[model samples]
Target: MAYRRLSNQSLVGVLIVLVGVVLLVDTTGLYDTGFLLTYVPSLFVLVGLYALVSSDFRNVGGPLVLVTVASAWQLVALDVVTVGRILRFWPLLIVLVGLSIALGRVRPSVAEVDDDRFDLVAAFGGLDRRATSKTFTGGNVTVAFGGGELDLRDTLVPAPPARVNVVALFGGVDVVVPRDWNVRLDVLPVFGAAEDDRPRREAEHDGVDLVVTGFCAFGGVTVTN
Candidate 1:
């Protein structure tokens, strides 16, 4: 059979053996003491090994290795060898390290801004509050909102022919427009709904044309003119 990927347990066992050898040779005085004290070194070895296996070493491995080394130095400095002392604090250490690793895994999207427009895109893995807004020159504008709330409004300049394109996905989008402006809105099926509070009459003044599109998993969109 083809060789399968090694399990975390096997990796941990190898690391434990190596650490035990080093500890035994480096600290011969350990055997003179009771076995209860040996748990401290064992615990540190296990934690260091676990961190190495669980962490994404390629991208974040260097810092994590540094942390493990620092922790080992601290243990040596304090002479933490007693099993009772090790057990008393092991749970707290594990919890703290686990939480830190979890938080470090979170990544955010990149936002780019140019002279004429701003573009933002991100893959928010399940639990993220999407909130953003941008304003630029009212010429061929495009807006997209997905899986969250989007509020877009355009201020009409004294100039004529202001065109906007807006796209929203799966969530709610709200847009505000001038009272007396000629505007056109086209929404795809992906967008939940579109509403206009203003009366359905042609505006006497030249107004801004806003178009929006995007998708959301749960939230809805709202537009006001």
Candidate 2:
């Protein structure tokens, strides 16, 4: 198989550049320490931009934009808003996810696709959701300094196999797939580990295959049935 560089690799590079710039500014005494954290939310917007341009990841970009802006709002409210009051705004994720799914980013009439692909991201937070695709093709999962739970156990896959690409940096990702399917682990972890929990005997020739491939940097990947 030909090696395909993931489109989100650009997003990862941009994040690294942003972090470097922030450090350089702080080193030059141009900005204080906490200053960098405030602009951290913009990382999502940057990722959203990358996704917006990618044919496969466009559907996920909008939700990332919305979540980033809402998270930034919470940061701005730090002066007058109480912790509880700020926490109340957390429900915006549910609303945004619903809206994104309702107003899908992918077209229903697209060829070779049974359903539109969606993106899931978790940055300094957690995500727990499922896909509505009957013949789920594939999507991306990104976690930066946070945790994410992607439940695809209920997803129908009349298609033979699907890919779920993941990138976890200083975070954790838990992928839940159907019990009867076979999970192929093709991940490379640098200061982390990827565990495939599917039963070897039962899932030997499996109904379908889920290829879990990606890189984990100082993070973890857990696959469960």
Candidate 3:
């Protein structure tokens, strides 16, 4: 069965709300912010729960759980490292993004767009989606302080002409459609770029037409074949 579009923001929002609730609980004088150390591991645990519920979260949640364990190991086994120690491991974020890309590839293949409406939003993180749809018409994608990717490389475009509304601020969105599809870009790029990287052909667009209309502020949108 298909699940709701689980973007990075949605997952991060869950973690944030959890942390806020913990802090809110502590505000009753039961414990201080330091007490959060006791429940730090729960952060990744909750993300893990989302992983089990939504396939879209598995790629991100799995690596987050691993990172949490590593962090906990440093905190407990290494006598509580300082914030600088954690920053040193920031490169792992790139590694996790690589893992997310690889993880997305190994997922079981399915028809991605079974619904008429689809929404994807990424904030404070990155989301990679490779999908197929026989009934896909139009949708919306938003990215802020983050990035998102939509790969429709191998999909059936029942709707030849579809529109995708994109909003990127301090972030970017990358799209991959069929090679033969005609791309109409109408995005306002402010201190940013919106480009089509596909090789051009003079042939007519007998396949599908993807009109990308959006706003990019301090960010960009890329369309590739």
What TM-score would each prediction reach against the true structure? 0.31, 0.55, 0.52
When sorted by TM-score, best at the front, the candidate numbers are: 2, 3, 1
- Per-model C-alpha lDDT, please? 0.40, 0.67, 0.67
Candidate 3: residue 109 lDDT (0-100)? 36
> Which window of ten consecutive residues has the lowest lDDT sum in model 2?
105-114
Positional deviation of residue 88's Cα in model 2 after best superposition, in angstroms: 24
lDDT against true structure, model 3: 0.67
Q: List, residue by residue over 1-225, the lDDT tens digit for candidate 1.
A: 899665433444475486677567557864443343444544554454444343322113323443554565556546765545545655555565565566557734221223233222211111122223233433221122223222233343334443333333333444455555455554444425555556743354444444443332233334455
Residue 79, model 3: lDDT of 55
RMSD per model, one decimal: 18.7, 8.5, 8.0
Question: Which parts of model 2 have CA positions greater than 4 angstroms off?
Answer: 1-9, 17-115, 201-203, 206-208
Highest-scoring model, TM-score: 2
Clashing pairs in 3: none
Error of 1 at 171 (Å): 1.1
